[model samples]
Target: MAGVIQEFKEFAVKGNVVDMAIGIIIGASFTTIVKSLVDDIFMPIVGLLTGGVDFTDFFITLKGAGEYPTLAAARAAGAVTINLGLFINACIAFLIVAWIMFMVVKAMNRLQRKAEAGTADVPPPRQEVLLEEIRDALVRNSTRP
Candidate 1:
Protein backbone atom coordinates (compact mmCIF):
# COMPACT_ATOMS: atom_id res chain seq x y z
CA MET A 1 0.00 0.00 0.00
CA ALA A 2 2.81 2.38 0.85
CA GLY A 3 4.57 1.58 -2.39
CA VAL A 4 1.37 2.22 -4.33
CA ILE A 5 0.83 5.51 -2.53
CA GLN A 6 4.41 6.58 -3.19
CA GLU A 7 4.05 5.72 -6.89
CA PHE A 8 0.83 7.69 -7.08
CA LYS A 9 2.51 10.69 -5.42
CA GLU A 10 5.39 10.56 -7.85
CA PHE A 11 3.07 10.29 -10.83
CA ALA A 12 0.93 13.16 -9.61
CA VAL A 13 3.93 15.44 -9.20
CA LYS A 14 5.42 14.75 -12.63
CA GLY A 15 5.58 17.74 -15.00
CA ASN A 16 4.23 15.65 -17.91
CA VAL A 17 1.18 14.58 -15.92
CA VAL A 18 0.50 18.15 -14.81
CA ASP A 19 0.95 19.48 -18.35
CA MET A 20 -1.46 16.84 -19.70
CA ALA A 21 -4.10 17.77 -17.14
CA ILE A 22 -3.72 21.45 -18.02
CA GLY A 23 -3.95 20.62 -21.74
CA ILE A 24 -7.16 18.65 -21.22
CA ILE A 25 -8.74 21.47 -19.27
CA ILE A 26 -7.74 24.06 -21.87
CA GLY A 27 -8.91 21.78 -24.70
CA ALA A 28 -12.34 21.47 -23.13
CA SER A 29 -12.57 25.25 -22.85
CA PHE A 30 -11.42 25.65 -26.45
CA THR A 31 -14.11 23.15 -27.53
CA THR A 32 -16.80 25.32 -25.99
CA ILE A 33 -15.48 28.39 -27.82
CA VAL A 34 -15.34 26.49 -31.13
CA LYS A 35 -18.85 25.12 -30.64
CA SER A 36 -20.14 28.62 -30.03
CA LEU A 37 -18.32 29.97 -33.08
CA VAL A 38 -19.84 27.26 -35.26
CA ASP A 39 -23.36 27.37 -33.86
CA ASP A 40 -23.78 31.07 -33.14
CA ILE A 41 -21.52 32.91 -35.61
CA PHE A 42 -20.78 30.75 -38.68
CA MET A 43 -24.16 29.02 -38.87
CA PRO A 44 -26.00 32.34 -38.93
CA ILE A 45 -23.87 33.62 -41.81
CA VAL A 46 -24.33 30.31 -43.65
CA GLY A 47 -28.08 30.52 -43.13
CA LEU A 48 -28.09 34.07 -44.50
CA LEU A 49 -26.08 33.12 -47.56
CA THR A 50 -28.26 30.05 -48.22
CA GLY A 51 -31.53 32.05 -48.18
CA GLY A 52 -32.27 31.83 -44.46
CA VAL A 53 -32.17 28.06 -44.19
CA ASP A 54 -31.49 27.45 -40.50
CA PHE A 55 -29.51 24.29 -40.01
CA THR A 56 -30.53 23.77 -36.40
CA ASP A 57 -34.15 23.28 -37.48
CA PHE A 58 -33.23 20.81 -40.22
CA PHE A 59 -33.96 17.15 -39.46
CA ILE A 60 -35.55 14.04 -40.93
CA THR A 61 -38.28 12.21 -39.11
CA LEU A 62 -37.32 8.55 -38.79
CA LYS A 63 -40.30 7.17 -36.88
CA GLY A 64 -43.40 9.35 -36.91
CA ALA A 65 -46.59 9.89 -38.84
CA GLY A 66 -46.92 13.67 -38.34
CA GLU A 67 -44.68 16.06 -40.21
CA TYR A 68 -42.77 18.40 -37.92
CA PRO A 69 -41.27 21.67 -39.15
CA THR A 70 -38.36 21.84 -36.68
CA LEU A 71 -36.17 19.44 -34.69
CA ALA A 72 -37.48 20.84 -31.42
CA ALA A 73 -41.07 20.28 -32.54
CA ALA A 74 -40.30 16.72 -33.56
CA ARG A 75 -38.71 16.04 -30.18
CA ALA A 76 -41.65 17.70 -28.43
CA ALA A 77 -44.07 15.44 -30.33
CA GLY A 78 -42.13 12.39 -29.13
CA ALA A 79 -41.08 11.60 -32.70
CA VAL A 80 -37.73 10.07 -33.57
CA THR A 81 -35.63 12.34 -35.73
CA ILE A 82 -32.13 12.31 -37.25
CA ASN A 83 -30.80 15.77 -36.45
CA LEU A 84 -28.41 16.29 -39.34
CA GLY A 85 -28.09 20.02 -38.69
CA LEU A 86 -26.72 19.47 -35.17
CA PHE A 87 -24.30 16.94 -36.58
CA ILE A 88 -23.19 19.49 -39.18
CA ASN A 89 -22.61 22.07 -36.46
CA ALA A 90 -20.53 19.54 -34.51
CA CYS A 91 -18.49 18.78 -37.63
CA ILE A 92 -17.83 22.48 -38.24
CA ALA A 93 -16.67 22.91 -34.63
CA PHE A 94 -14.37 19.91 -34.96
CA LEU A 95 -12.85 21.30 -38.17
CA ILE A 96 -12.23 24.69 -36.61
CA VAL A 97 -10.53 23.12 -33.58
CA ALA A 98 -8.45 20.85 -35.82
CA TRP A 99 -7.30 23.76 -37.99
CA ILE A 100 -6.33 25.88 -34.98
CA MET A 101 -4.37 22.99 -33.45
CA PHE A 102 -2.63 22.38 -36.75
CA MET A 103 -1.58 26.01 -37.00
CA VAL A 104 -0.32 25.99 -33.42
CA VAL A 105 1.73 22.84 -33.99
CA LYS A 106 3.15 24.24 -37.22
CA ALA A 107 4.20 27.46 -35.48
CA MET A 108 5.80 25.48 -32.64
CA ASN A 109 7.72 23.37 -35.13
CA ARG A 110 8.93 26.48 -36.92
CA LEU A 111 10.11 28.01 -33.65
CA GLN A 112 11.83 24.78 -32.64
CA ARG A 113 13.67 24.69 -35.97
CA LYS A 114 14.76 28.32 -35.60
CA ALA A 115 16.02 27.66 -32.05
CA GLU A 116 18.00 24.60 -33.21
CA ALA A 117 19.49 26.58 -36.07
CA GLY A 118 20.49 29.40 -33.76
CA THR A 119 22.13 27.01 -31.31
CA ALA A 120 24.16 25.41 -34.12
CA ASP A 121 25.62 28.80 -35.12
CA VAL A 122 26.83 29.61 -31.60
CA PRO A 123 30.62 29.33 -30.93
CA PRO A 124 32.02 27.25 -28.10
CA PRO A 125 32.70 29.02 -24.76
CA ARG A 126 36.11 30.67 -24.26
CA GLN A 127 36.81 28.37 -21.29
CA GLU A 128 36.19 25.29 -23.46
CA VAL A 129 38.51 26.65 -26.18
CA LEU A 130 41.29 27.29 -23.67
CA LEU A 131 40.82 23.84 -22.12
CA GLU A 132 41.09 22.18 -25.54
CA GLU A 133 44.31 24.14 -26.32
CA ILE A 134 45.85 23.11 -22.96
CA ARG A 135 44.91 19.46 -23.57
CA ASP A 136 46.47 19.58 -27.05
CA ALA A 137 49.67 21.17 -25.66
CA LEU A 138 49.90 18.48 -22.94
CA VAL A 139 49.43 15.75 -25.58
CA ARG A 140 52.16 17.27 -27.80
CA ASN A 141 54.60 17.59 -24.86
CA SER A 142 53.89 14.01 -23.70
CA THR A 143 54.50 12.71 -27.23
CA ARG A 144 57.85 14.58 -27.40
CA PRO A 145 59.06 13.26 -24.00
Candidate 2:
Protein backbone atom coordinates (compact mmCIF):
# COMPACT_ATOMS: atom_id res chain seq x y z
CA MET A 1 0.00 0.00 0.00
CA ALA A 2 2.83 2.39 0.86
CA GLY A 3 4.64 1.52 -2.37
CA VAL A 4 1.47 2.11 -4.36
CA ILE A 5 0.91 5.47 -2.67
CA GLN A 6 4.49 6.57 -3.37
CA GLU A 7 4.21 5.50 -7.00
CA PHE A 8 0.95 7.35 -7.38
CA LYS A 9 2.51 10.48 -5.88
CA GLU A 10 5.45 10.29 -8.31
CA PHE A 11 3.18 9.71 -11.31
CA ALA A 12 0.79 12.49 -10.39
CA VAL A 13 3.57 14.97 -9.77
CA LYS A 14 5.47 14.23 -13.02
CA GLY A 15 5.91 17.27 -15.27
CA ASN A 16 4.20 15.60 -18.24
CA VAL A 17 1.22 14.47 -16.19
CA VAL A 18 0.85 17.88 -14.53
CA ASP A 19 1.10 19.60 -17.89
CA MET A 20 -1.54 17.32 -19.36
CA ALA A 21 -3.91 18.00 -16.51
CA ILE A 22 -3.45 21.75 -16.87
CA GLY A 23 -4.03 21.43 -20.65
CA ILE A 24 -7.26 19.52 -20.05
CA ILE A 25 -8.52 22.18 -17.66
CA ILE A 26 -7.69 24.97 -20.07
CA GLY A 27 -9.24 23.03 -22.95
CA ALA A 28 -12.50 22.72 -21.04
CA SER A 29 -12.58 26.48 -20.52
CA PHE A 30 -11.71 27.12 -24.14
CA THR A 31 -14.54 24.85 -25.25
CA THR A 32 -16.99 26.92 -23.24
CA ILE A 33 -15.73 30.12 -24.88
CA VAL A 34 -15.89 28.53 -28.32
CA LYS A 35 -19.43 27.33 -27.72
CA SER A 36 -20.50 30.83 -26.78
CA LEU A 37 -18.80 32.25 -29.84
CA VAL A 38 -20.55 29.79 -32.13
CA ASP A 39 -23.97 29.96 -30.51
CA ASP A 40 -24.21 33.61 -29.50
CA ILE A 41 -22.01 35.43 -32.03
CA PHE A 42 -21.53 33.45 -35.23
CA MET A 43 -24.93 31.84 -35.36
CA PRO A 44 -26.70 35.17 -34.93
CA ILE A 45 -24.76 36.77 -37.77
CA VAL A 46 -25.35 33.73 -39.95
CA GLY A 47 -29.06 33.85 -39.17
CA LEU A 48 -29.24 37.51 -40.15
CA LEU A 49 -27.41 36.93 -43.42
CA THR A 50 -29.71 34.01 -44.25
CA GLY A 51 -32.81 36.17 -43.66
CA GLY A 52 -33.42 35.47 -39.97
CA VAL A 53 -33.36 31.70 -40.22
CA ASP A 54 -32.52 30.27 -36.80
CA PHE A 55 -30.26 27.30 -37.34
CA THR A 56 -30.97 26.01 -33.86
CA ASP A 57 -34.55 25.44 -34.96
CA PHE A 58 -33.34 23.18 -37.74
CA PHE A 59 -34.20 19.65 -36.64
CA ILE A 60 -35.78 16.43 -37.82
CA THR A 61 -38.70 15.30 -35.71
CA LEU A 62 -38.73 11.54 -35.74
CA LYS A 63 -41.51 10.88 -33.25
CA GLY A 64 -43.44 14.11 -32.82
CA ALA A 65 -46.36 15.49 -34.82
CA GLY A 66 -45.88 19.24 -34.28
CA GLU A 67 -43.56 22.14 -35.04
CA TYR A 68 -41.05 23.37 -32.49
CA PRO A 69 -39.89 26.99 -32.21
CA THR A 70 -36.69 25.96 -30.44
CA LEU A 71 -34.76 22.97 -29.14
CA ALA A 72 -36.12 23.55 -25.65
CA ALA A 73 -39.67 23.53 -26.95
CA ALA A 74 -39.06 20.30 -28.81
CA ARG A 75 -37.65 18.69 -25.69
CA ALA A 76 -40.47 20.03 -23.52
CA ALA A 77 -42.99 18.58 -25.96
CA GLY A 78 -41.22 15.23 -25.55
CA ALA A 79 -40.28 15.20 -29.22
CA VAL A 80 -37.51 12.94 -30.43
CA THR A 81 -35.37 15.14 -32.61
CA ILE A 82 -32.02 14.89 -34.31
CA ASN A 83 -30.69 18.39 -33.78
CA LEU A 84 -28.69 19.30 -36.88
CA GLY A 85 -27.95 22.80 -35.63
CA LEU A 86 -26.27 21.55 -32.47
CA PHE A 87 -24.15 19.25 -34.61
CA ILE A 88 -23.19 22.19 -36.80
CA ASN A 89 -22.32 24.30 -33.76
CA ALA A 90 -20.16 21.46 -32.42
CA CYS A 91 -18.43 21.12 -35.81
CA ILE A 92 -17.61 24.81 -35.89
CA ALA A 93 -16.17 24.70 -32.39
CA PHE A 94 -14.06 21.67 -33.29
CA LEU A 95 -12.64 23.44 -36.35
CA ILE A 96 -11.75 26.51 -34.29
CA VAL A 97 -9.94 24.38 -31.69
CA ALA A 98 -8.13 22.35 -34.35
CA TRP A 99 -6.95 25.46 -36.20
CA ILE A 100 -5.68 27.09 -33.02
CA MET A 101 -3.83 23.92 -32.00
CA PHE A 102 -2.25 23.63 -35.45
CA MET A 103 -1.00 27.21 -35.23
CA VAL A 104 0.46 26.61 -31.76
CA VAL A 105 2.28 23.47 -32.93
CA LYS A 106 3.63 25.31 -35.99
CA ALA A 107 5.00 28.11 -33.85
CA MET A 108 6.57 25.66 -31.39
CA ASN A 109 8.17 23.71 -34.24
CA ARG A 110 9.62 26.92 -35.70
CA LEU A 111 11.15 27.84 -32.34
CA GLN A 112 12.56 24.33 -31.96
CA ARG A 113 14.15 24.54 -35.42
CA LYS A 114 15.76 27.87 -34.57
CA ALA A 115 17.10 26.49 -31.28
CA GLU A 116 18.55 23.43 -33.05
CA ALA A 117 20.16 25.61 -35.73
CA GLY A 118 21.73 27.84 -33.11
CA THR A 119 23.54 24.78 -31.64
CA ALA A 120 25.22 23.96 -35.00
CA ASP A 121 28.00 26.50 -34.26
CA VAL A 122 29.04 24.61 -31.10
CA PRO A 123 32.46 22.81 -31.16
CA PRO A 124 32.83 19.11 -30.39
CA PRO A 125 34.73 17.80 -27.34
CA ARG A 126 38.61 17.85 -27.30
CA GLN A 127 38.65 14.07 -26.68
CA GLU A 128 36.93 13.45 -30.04
CA VAL A 129 39.43 15.78 -31.82
CA LEU A 130 42.44 13.92 -30.37
CA LEU A 131 40.88 10.54 -31.29
CA GLU A 132 40.33 11.67 -34.89
CA GLU A 133 43.96 12.90 -35.14
CA ILE A 134 45.25 9.53 -33.86
CA ARG A 135 43.13 7.66 -36.42
CA ASP A 136 44.40 9.90 -39.24
CA ALA A 137 48.06 9.35 -38.16
CA LEU A 138 47.59 5.53 -38.08
CA VAL A 139 45.99 5.62 -41.56
CA ARG A 140 48.90 7.74 -42.92
CA ASN A 141 51.57 5.33 -41.50
CA SER A 142 49.75 2.22 -42.87
CA THR A 143 49.39 3.73 -46.34
CA ARG A 144 53.21 4.37 -46.71
CA PRO A 145 53.68 0.69 -47.77
- What is the Å distance of residue 138 in model 2 from its true position? 19
lDDT of 1 by residue, 8-45 (tens): 99999999999999999999999989988998999999
Q: Tell me the TM-score of model 2.
A: 0.80
TM-score against truth, every candidate: 0.87, 0.80
Q: Which ranges of candidate 2 are over 4 A from the true structure?
A: 124-145
Model 1 TM: 0.87
How would you encode candidate 2's per-residue C-alpha lDDT over 91-135 as one tens digit per residue?
A: 988998899999999999999999999998788899999999999
> Candidate 1: worst 10 consecutive residues by lDDT?
64-73
